[model samples]
Target: MLLSGHCLIVLERTVLAASPAEGCALLIGRRHAEALWVQRIWPCCNRWEPASERQRHFQLDPREQLLAQRWVRERGLQVLGAAHSHPSSPAVPSLSDRERSLGPTLLLIRSGLTDDPHPLRAWWLPEPAALPGPAPEALPLPLEAPLTGDLGE
Candidate 1:
């Protein structure tokens, strides 16, 4: 996937600011050929129950998701997928993440509160039925930078 320069910055700042809680956002963009180009970052609230688990888990607010879907539809864009931060773990998908993922979609994770070696990563989760067994395996995907646009919309 190719992220607009602005999207990347917004993602970084959002995740950084959400230190104690997991920051979440919806990726809005259009697909061309096999690549998804991110045009905007629609920030969302993490509404996981039991505030104590906020650090290790995140639930994207359903209301925000519905609103995002409507907003993107109006702009001829798609809700590509989602992004979230991992306060203390690496950027890779955790066991719960793999099991919870509704696949054939993109999932971006930002690890650590600070700039760790692998602060950010993306994964492609396949459709559950497509898997050979019960195990959920997420394939790593690249997060690329586009050639222009440093400011976000």
Candidate 2:
């Protein structure tokens, strides 16, 4: 499905903010372009290095996960996708990343430092059930700064 205009804007901003050390979230809706509606979810990250892995990986901190759960409940929205920055590499997901993904989720990879030339890339990790169904679709979209102010306002 195509991203709504507003959602596109938010996704861009999230990509811009990613660093190798942290990750971000985006709440999405299945809707048409003109009537775009989306929310940006900035969840907390718990960083850890896997025994067999060299790159740092992160999971949602409890509080952040709670917040995400609540936000989804209150808004009746889906977790459309998530994003993270790779301090040293591109925002692409590693093998571990693929194993941890939950659904037809969006993965945004950012390269370099958080404040430096943060190029955003997008990928979709389909549910295991979807494997052998079709090839994953990767779309390259421009990352734009997010609109400011509370979502409720």
Candidate 3:
């Protein structure tokens, strides 16, 4: 997965703003050859009902996800990935997270609110599981940033 620097900043700010609640967003970009490059990050609400606590769980509203799908199509881009914050924990997927996950979607998890870049991690979930499986292994998704000496955006 590739994310531009601008989009990453926006994602961090959005996630931090949500604070104790799990913030979620749709990663938007297109596929080129074999890689996904993220061009936009669309922030959405947590919308998980009856959350006695939101520090560890999040449910993306169906409506917002559908809208995001439509927007992706209209923009001629694909849903490059999904992202969420992990409020009080690490960026690793929880047991519940692994059980509910669908494969082949790149997932970005931000563990804490710090501006330092150490809290984020990415994973690739393989899809169409015949049964619920163990947590998908984590991936080393590098933040897609412009290299030095490149022209400004």
- Please report the candidate that would top lDDT against the real structure: 1
Model 1 quality (TM-score): 0.84
Q: Which candidate wins on TM-score?
A: 1
Clashing pairs in 1: none
Runs in model 2 lying further than 4 Å from the true structure: 1-20, 26-38, 47-55, 113-118, 129-137, 142-153
Each candidate's TM vs. the true structure? 0.84, 0.61, 0.83
Candidate lDDT scores, in order, read 0.79, 0.56, 0.78
Query: Residue by residue across 55-115, what tens digits does model 2's lDDT show?
Result: 4666655676667767776877756666665656655666666777786676666555455
How does candidate 2 fare on TM-score?
A: 0.61
Clashing pairs in 3: 103-125, 103-126, 103-127, 104-125
Each model's RMSD to truth, in Å? 3.2, 5.8, 3.3
Better of 1 and 2 by lDDT: 1
lDDT of 3 at 143: 66
Candidate 1's displacement at residue 135, Å, is 9.1
Per-residue lDDT, model 1, residue 94, is 75
Ranking by lDDT: 1, 3, 2
